[model samples]
Structures are given as C-alpha cells and as structure tokens.
Target: MTVDRLGYLGFDASDVDAWSRYANNTLGMMTAAKGKDSDRYRLDSRAWRLAVHRGEADDISYAGFEAADAAAFNSTAERLRQMGYQVTNEPDDLKADRGVIDLVSVIDPSGVRIEVYYGATELFEVPFVSPVGVSSFVTGEQGFGHIVLATPDLEKSMEFYVAGLGMELSDIIDWDLGPGGKHKLHFFNCNRRHHSLALLPAPAPKHIHHFMIESASLDDVGRAIDRMERDSRILLTFGRHTNDHMYSFYGITPSGFAVEFGCGPRDVDRSWSVVRYDSISMWGHKFISPE
Candidate 1:
C-alpha cells in the first residue's frame, strides 16, 4: 500500500457561489466548472486539485490519495480487502468526473471517504495562472497539501491511515487546553512535505478541522493575510508550527471549515525523528473572534 501523495479534495458546501469567490478572489486558485452544481479548483498542472459541490454538508466529501502507478493502486485495494475493509472499484462515470484513470473507494474508521487512484489528468500546456496573482503553490510531488481531520476515534483512525495506508508517523503534538484537558494530534507523512494528513480526537460539527494550502512565496502569505483581514475572515493569527514549522494563518472558508494558508514549511527527510511537542505553534495562532 504505497500511497504517493494527497492528490485532491472534494467538499460539499451549501453555497457554491461563496466558495467560488473564496477560492478565486482570496485563495488565488484557478477554477473550472465540474458540472452544473460543482466547481473544481486548480493549484498547479493537475486538472483539478480541489472541488466544491452544492450541498448542505459543509464538510469534506472525499479525499483522493494518489498511488505511484496502476500496480500500486491495485495492491492498495487488495491490501485493504485483506485487512477486512470493503473496497469498491468506482465506476467509469466517477473516473471521468475525478479525471483519473482508475480509483477505488473505502471508508475509514471515522467514516471519512477515501479514494485511491492513479493517472490523474494533467494540463501542462495550460499553465496555471493564479486569479489573484499568487505566483505559485507548493504542489507537485507533495500534491495539493495537507488535511486535518477531527476523528471521534483517534486510535482507530491511526490504524486505518498509518497501518492500512502505509503512511509514516512524522510527529505528535500534545496540546494542553487547560480546562479542555490534553489533546494529542498525530501527524503522518507519505512524502517530503511533512504530514499530508493529521488526526485529532475531537467532536465537531464537521469532519474536517481544516485543509492546508502552501504557497511557494512567503510574500503570497503576507498578501493573503491582508485579504483575510480586509474580509474579516481570519480565524487564527499568523504562526509557526512546532513540528512542521509552517509559517501560516487560518482563515474561515465559505463552508465554515478553516483553511491554513502558509509558506516555508520544513520538509521531512530521512534523518527525521518523531518527537512530541507540548504546543501546536511556537509563536502566534491566536484565536480571532468574528465579533
């Protein structure tokens, strides 16, 4: 089960128009209509890296994990079946919709829909030009970026992702929330971009805590901060994480989940040793009130 990278993400939002504005005007992503009710966003050469469909869920609908090739994809599906999980070979309609050659769908312990696929549609001829002049996003081998999920059962979630999907544990953050007690967040990496997925034991209205998008330039982050502030969408102030050391800020997406826009995250290398950190961020990340 060699999952190469976190490829693409899909969300169900109540207001697709609001999401379109957020992705285009604020996040600086290029967008294309998936159909009548869905819109897909592009971060790089890939046809689409993120999508929002008109729905009331207002949460992550599915997460697509890329396999290195067709062999790896088949191996992963077989491995999941051997592990007693029901893996479904998705239909051609879905394959065409996702712009992938083939894909298999499975449910994690936390009930998050996971899609593993290969041969994603690439558009190298149509160079990515950010709508708001973001310069470029940190994608390519690292894929679209990271996703933080709030799981009811953290241990089972870990087993499904780490053991089942073959993701390597990067580090853990033991955050103390005073009256809220201690919360442990587990980070896992499938590539060099630190953790592509993180799990936190908590109860939330939504399945996702947030999904991150990294920019190639630190200046892009600065400009994003300005836009978020102007629109009163800042959820968490600027900060540097203890583990990945990503210089970022959390902004409220139109769907109600947070989106971390950042730059300059330290990579995970062979020398990386897993360690527990007492805090989530070294500096800021203060909670901002919409009041």
Candidate 2:
C-alpha cells in the first residue's frame, strides 16, 4: 500500500533557541513544550508537525510518512522488505516519544531516515494559534506539506520511493544551469497534493534541499515576506513554480537548508498528466543573498 501523506519532520538543530524564534515569529507556527533539549511545533490539529532536537547536524534527522491505518502500515513495511530493503520496527518507548501508535523506519538510497506509521496524536481541544497570526496551514488530508531531497543517485532514489514506497510520478523538471550542466528533478505524489516528495540529482552538504509548508491565505504569505526581509533570510525571491504552480518564497532556516512558504498550489487529480518542464519556476523565484 502507498503511504498517505507527508506526516511530520524531525530536525537535528545546532541552536534550539534560533529554531524556536524562527518557527514562532518567522513561520508563525505554534510551539509545544516537548522538552528542554528539544522543541516541537504544531501546524494544525496534530500534536506536532515538526520537531527540532538539539544536535550539531542542523539538517533533517528523519521524515515521517503516515499510513492510513494499521493494515496500511503493515503492508508498507512488508512491501519494503520484499524490495530488498531493511525495515526496522521501532520500540514502544520510541513510539510513545513520537506520539504514534506504531512506527517502522527505513533508510532511503540517499541515506535519509523514513518513518512510516499510523495513529498520530491530535490536539484539537487545544486549538492551534499561530504566534505570528497566520490564519491556518493547509494540512489535513494533504499532510504536512512536501520535502525535496538532494541525492547523488537519482535513479536509485526514484526506485526506492516509487517502486518500493508506491509513490506515483507527478512530473519532472530538467533545469539547465548553463556551464554548470543540467539537473533533473522528479516529483512524486501519494495523494491530491500535487507532490509530497521530490528528488534532485546532485551533491549537497545536507540530505534535504528544502521542505515546503503551504498557507491557507495569500495574505499570510505576503506578511511572511515582510518578516523574512526584515531578518534578511530570503533565499529565493517570491515566485510561482512551473510544475505545481506554487506561489512561494524560499527562506534560510536556522540550519543552512531552505524552507518554502507558499499558498495556492494546484492539486493532482485523476486527470493529471505527467510532463517535463525546462525551468523551475514560471515567474519570479530569483536567487537572492540572505544578507
């Protein structure tokens, strides 16, 4: 069985304090008290969508993919084993820590940890209130947005995510960098959200290039641009993507990787057709310095 959507993300951050301010003030996420050494932020009804643990890596530690139920979770774990990949069933204490009923992990070809499970803890009674007054985040069925990973072997990564994990190919983008050569980006979808994961063939210092979070309103995005500009964290100027048509901007996280904040991306449907694009964005998205 294919996974549901992008559930949650964990980051090993060097400075937890920086992440706290960034998540609260810059991204407008609600902070939850996880512990003194770690920080957890809520995006919707879910107990937490993103977690930051104190560490030196300052990159994505693990990505959690949700299964609709126990059956789906079991089927996915079995499918991974059949594809010649080792799957680990995590212990009870770890499951408690993650606030999930069950959890199994597998490492992708790019060496990023992938956690698959079901039964996430929801805090609906508590209600989500964005510190920076973001109206809401587009989560629920679409999951907790998407993640783009940089891998050395695109084919191998595609095989693992597509053939093994059951993610369908959404579209492709072959970007030409003049003398630097060409780079092909493959986007995959598990649900209606245009894409929940993407793969880029390149060498990078970190496992992840960026993770995207969608806002419910365009006004929220406009206000975020102001905050990023004040902090000089804008990594890529405002732009609309060519493939998914996401109107978003990239900003430097406390860690070195980028975070794409946007709204109003077209959803994938049964009538969707796979196509390739020559460029990454339709308009805007100019690379900018974070000075």
Model 2, residue 273: what's the lDDT?
Answer: 98
lDDT of all predictions: 0.91, 0.92
lDDT of 2 by residue, 88-164 (tens): 99999889889999999999999999999899999989999999999999999999999999999988899898877
TM-scores, all models, native as reference: 0.97, 0.97
Clashes, model 1? 0
| Candidate 1 clash pair list | none
Q: Measured by TM-score, how close is model 1 to the native structure? A: 0.97
What range of 10 consecutive residues in model 1 has the weakest lDDT sum?
A: 31-40
Q: Give one digit per residue, the lDDT tens place, for model 1 in 1-291.
A: 589899999999999888888899899999864743579999999999998988999999999999989888998888888889999999998898888999999999888899999999999999999988998999999998999998999888888887778899999999776676888989999999999999989777899999999999889999999988876489999999999999999999988899999999999998999999989999999988878
